[model samples]
Target: MDIEKIAKAIEMDAGERLPDIRESLQEMVDGKAASVHTPEQLMLRTTRQKLGLSQSDFARLIRTPVTTLCDWEQGRFNPPGSLMCLVEIADKRPDVLRDVLM
Candidate 1:
């Protein structure tokens, strides 16, 4: 086996592969190939943003840990059905949720 030729071939292969990988990443960043989030994940993030609450505040309002809330929002874990129902209610009626929590 010729080591110098093998190394050159490997470098050329990597150079060729990088452009496609970079293009795919750029597409994602440009929202042309955005990753799909589950409905629960979308709800978790949107509800908090609509409520104008930070992750910690939203987690407190929902009686959950901040890390768990982050996990749900990031799609590392799904929120429970019960939590989803509450999130829907919150999304539709932010004032009511706040008033009840108060």
Candidate 2:
């Protein structure tokens, strides 16, 4: 079935494909790796504090609830979909709060 010819072709192409695949894979890895954050916790804490509201008030502002916010901050519960999006945007660009919050 011309296996030798096929193998030779593969061998020649593998060098090019491998590096391209590897570079794309590394870029994906780097993109994912960069997402890890601590600022969500900090901002959730600090901004709420500065506003002189308990977790309850922040939760109300976010339209969740005190218990949910507590659970999220304390790591007992994961932030749900919309909240998680807000958290990511907020953490990354806190200066955009007015825009993001809207």
Candidate 3:
């Protein structure tokens, strides 16, 4: 085939020949799901370290147990489905979320 014709064919068939983009999009979706954390979780996790609050204190502020927040941070398991929804909603309006949560 002529070089120009081959180039056109490659361009047209690239998605079929290269499925990596589909996988990349899926990975982004998964990361978004995994990265989410509740406003209370985010606020406590981000600030308590600076304030020198013990995990126990931070847990009380966030109304959760030390073990649960520890597990959330460590990726042992995610917050509950309802908390995920709050996280995602907060993420969409980060400025407002940060101000209110902080």
Candidate 4:
């Protein structure tokens, strides 16, 4: 990887591009512009962190194989709609899953 190029890009993003990007994303959130992200792009790592679970624990909780969970986290494959729904539910209402599991 070109470390110098990556560093320059990071510097540029922090110094100049971040504000415009943030504004554009805000506009999209406010319905002033179209979204740049899709629901399917919900990152597995973020969801797992929100649920306060490790990959192994989360995979068990979701009743999926750890290998599958790792694949999702690594972006090797996208989870199906049903799994996505479960992930959304776990991210938004973790208590629901916790309650059900008890």
Candidate 5:
């Protein structure tokens, strides 16, 4: 598709514009960019990590099959809104879920 245009855009000089780009990139590499993502898309892996659970454990916690959880995390299929809401809740308040699980 527009390879030449893309190459040109990438080759453009960084003449003081966005001086923080290098620092920001390094911070992201070091897992310090906490505010990078928007609410429009929730990363399944990130949500799962926030719960401090392994894939198997997370699957069990949500009562979803491991294959389905894997598909959702790999982006093979987007989770339905109801499942998304549960994931978000687990991410934001693991204590609430832990009580229910117990």
Candidate 6:
């Protein structure tokens, strides 16, 4: 295999794509680009935010490990249906959840 040739070609390709990459990043920063989030992720994050809690606090309040909560929020894992139902309730009635659960 011609490793050196392959490396050089990759470098050239990256250089050629740099401008487009920068433009895409700029668009994201300018809010011209939209990023997709799954419904579960959105709901979990929204619930936590609505309760005005940080990840660790929210995780503790929900009795889940912070890492697991992070996984759910980042869409790396799907929270169970029961957890989703709780999250929906929390999202809709943050005050109630906080009052009852906290």
Q: Rate the local accuracy (lDDT) of all candidates.
A: 0.82, 0.62, 0.58, 0.72, 0.70, 0.81
List the candidate 6 regions with Cα displacement exceeding 4 Å: 1-36
Score residue 16 of candidate 5 by CA lDDT.
Answer: 32
For candidate 6, report its TM-score: 0.63
lDDT of 6 by residue, 1-102 (tens): 454455556658877534355445556567795666899899889878877899999999989899999999998898999999999888777778878988
Give the per-residue lDDT digits (tens) of candidate 1, residues 1-102: 454455556658877534345555556557695667997898789989998999999999989999999999999888899999889999999889989994
Top TM-score prediction, candidate number: 1
Winner on lDDT (5 vs 6): 6
Off by over 4 Å in 3: 1-44, 80-102
lDDT at residue 9 of model 4 (Cα atoms): 76
lDDT tens string, model 5, 1-102? Answer: 454444345446543345455555566567784543334235567888887789899889889899988877766677788888876777788788788873
Model 5 residue runs over 4 Å out of place are 1-42
Candidate 2 displacement at residue 91 in angstroms:
2.6
Question: Candidates sorted by TM-score, descending order?
Answer: 1, 6, 5, 4, 2, 3
Model 2: runs farther than 4 Å from truth? Answer: 1-53, 99-102
Residue-wise lDDT of candidate 2 within 1-102, one digit each (tens)? 454455456658775433344444556656654334355555566666665667876687688878878877766656666776665555566557546454
Per-model TM-score, in order, reads: 0.66, 0.42, 0.34, 0.59, 0.60, 0.63
Off by over 4 Å in 1: 1-34
lDDT of 3 by residue, 1-102 (tens): 254444456657774454354554556556654365655556535555654567786566456888987886555676687655544554456555447655
Q: Which candidate is the best by lDDT?
A: 1
Model 4, range 1-102, lDDT digits (tens) per residue? 454455557668677544355454456567785534444545667888887889899888888899998877766677888988877787888899799863
